[model samples]
Target: MARASATPRSSAYLSALSQEIEKKLQRALASPPQRRNLLQELFADVALEVDDRARDIILSREEDTISPADDSHLGQLCFYDVLADYYVQAPESGKPILDLIVQLWSQSFASHIFSLLFHKWLFEVQLDNPEVLLRYSSALAQGATNVFWIDIQTNTRRFQSLFCYLLDEVAVEPARLNKIPVQAQRDLYLLLSRFILFYNSGDKLDTFLKHCPTFPNAFLIGGPTDFFVTELADQLQKLKVEPVLLHYLSNLKVLQGMELRMATSTRLKTCLYSFTSPGGPMYPTRAVRHAAWDALDLLFPLFDWRSRTLHPVYSAHLQRRSTA
Candidate 1:
């Protein structure tokens, strides 16, 4: 994705911000005992929501002055967001920070900072060294997974833009997706599958499934749709948040007519059914139970036939639930 060049004023402010980050990283590198603390603090600083004062300076315009309070499109902007762009514009400016990150790679928040700031750079630049490329790709996947889970656990869209960029820019773009190794590509796709619905990217479902990477275990897991549904079903089983679960259930309508393996279909069916029941196992709330029923009805309208075709005891259970 092409980003507009920052204005001279914003560029200078971003340069200062970059220097502050680098100084902290350098301190971390110089003091082994303080490395983790310093890196953690740096990560927190970059992740902070851009305040009004910082916003005005970092996003200043040539013609009109930007209002600190005018947070129409900049509400979600963070220091990392500005710095990420800064690094993209001046790749050299980020080399020092990147080197510091590599030295402190084992510490907490190191990968998080790298992923947030250099996600675009990782894909945009060409790395000739295979080992280095693999390491960076692995780090990107690991870091992205960590941040995405934060969004999931809090049921917040704080990282929605990040997810969108990975999906829209990296996942779908062949050239960009191919930049990473096969293993990393597979990992990236799997990671995206689990959170796609959470981030409300169901509209891109068709495109996403179409470009899914070829997994070595395709025979075991079936095709792209099957793998995606399997991941999604597993995600459903893990979701404790009612709103996020319901959001997922509601989005299952998109899977209506896709052909899936019988086992894969059963896996999804069993997952949704777990929530439909009132007790034990899933023990879903009333709202979730109803939503699951809706999803089941939409995905498997003919599932009722299974009650009659199966054992009498199971048939009675289904009969009672239908009336209940």
Candidate 2:
């Protein structure tokens, strides 16, 4: 008699189950709202099954010892694709489904799932569609923040990579930075600033600051506020990433009538002075001081002092005096 086939019957069974699930999802999307409930139940069932397998695999081996090739043993790779596709198809419903699986799986397992979902969302989708990109990015930012904040130490690299990726994207297409909704922008930028202060170091930190844009709107709401600007200044000074700070400060513009504009200007001015103060490290460094001076000189003209009685000529005179 012929020997048993080399294929694992277990793998075959899982593959068939995945296909059936996909068919059920397609049907669910097409069917009435009541029928969709069955699809939701099926989704929960799949999450439970995958969660069990992932836990067993995680417990059987050490974290770093497990290789990508080992994902097959846990049926993780297949499920990763399936869940991501489900989310892409039905984002509203699929978000909760994805959340359930993440809560049910081990950290490593959840990370792998998130990685796949993020990859699909970032690389596969066309960024030209601003609305679609915003929705997806908001979802991704929220999901990653929720999952990783619990164990930030373990997820440091992921957060760092995300920060760098968004920075690069904005660096390339500066307009995209402001187009994102203020709330989403705050969420992403807050995460990035946290990464910069805690997770990043040396060359990576410098590079991030250097590429940081000068867009006025980028700094208005969700971008760097007064607190972050002050905090980032201290971090950069400690890291001796002063030149990068120069690039950052060079772009600082206090537009007229913006909310908190006066407070922002005051904070920025304090930060600039700190760079060139008597005991500051950059006080003796000509390049850093000059860069800081140039930035300050540029910013001095934009201060809306909001004086009701001061003449325009006096304001102009003061502006000219400061530059002189």
Candidate 3:
């Protein structure tokens, strides 16, 4: 995970940026009354998209050459993206910032900063102490969960790269996944399960399901597929954003042939059915209802077919309503 060394000029620019961040954190620590605001501002600074001018300076090299597409695959570069790489290259330089973060751990946006900056370090650095490793791992999971929820609520993909790294590099990669404690590993998988589709990562669903950790309640939940469906169903119930809900319903087709327990299947069916009607529980919009019906048709085709055969009147009723 080591990054290429930056040139002296770019390195200096990043060092100054780091100093600014450290200063803000230090100020936050000194002023109890303003700690929350300082920390929130710091989070915003790191999360802000890197502008064209800043991007050029941070990425400059001694050779006077930088690939225009260096960060293309990563979507857009953010301040944290450069800082995270800087910390990886110079871990010692980040110690002061890390110390400040630990002191303000309980404050808002603290974990978000930690996750964004140290996610790679957490995996790449060797922690001989199990207790420390677990603590850091827990913070990472919590921070990631918070930020992912931000994306869900706003219906944006701002945190998609973060999700992709955790899913692609850590969750499915056994060597890295095992870097954390078993409990943290399980928690991370479950967190990813809930937000997988929100981040447009449904393509990784099969690999993700294969790598799911064994849950303590597997006897009740069945297995990976069942646990995943259960989480997705619960997630579907909680979503209020029309676009995100439609995205979930559209992606639920991936579960069509997966072998789920009867209870799990029923739970998913009930969750989706709640969205198919314009009623109190779900209050799905017209678009969501149509998407839900399409999902139900894909997941449980025979249910509709059987209902049509046994109760033609009900089938016609649903058909008319759905078209309307």
For each candidate, what TM-score against the reference?
Answer: 0.89, 0.35, 0.91
What are the lDDT scores of the predictions, listed in order?
0.82, 0.44, 0.82
**Candidate 3 segments exceeding 4 Å error:** 1-4, 62-74, 302-324
Q: Superposing every Cα of model 3 onto the true structure, what RMSD results?
A: 2.9
Candidate 1 lDDT: 0.82
Q: Give the worst 10-residue stretch by lDDT in candidate 3.
A: 65-74
lDDT of 3 by residue, 2-84 (tens): 35467777778878988998999999999999999999899888988889898778767666555323632346777776777
User: Looking at candidate 3, what is the lDDT of residue 305?
Assistant: 56
Ten-residue region with minimum lDDT total, candidate 1: 65-74
Cα lDDT tens digits, model 2, 1-324, are 011121233334434554665455455445555444644455345433245564344224333333222323223333443344334433553444344434434323333334434434444333567675565556656555543343243332333333444545542344555555555555555545533434333234434444444445554533334434545545445434444444444444422222344655576566665554345454525565556656655655434458545433234344443433
Candidate 2: residue 58 Cα off by (Å)? 16
Model 1 ranges off by over 4 Å: 29-37, 63-75, 302-316, 320-324
Best by TM-score: 3
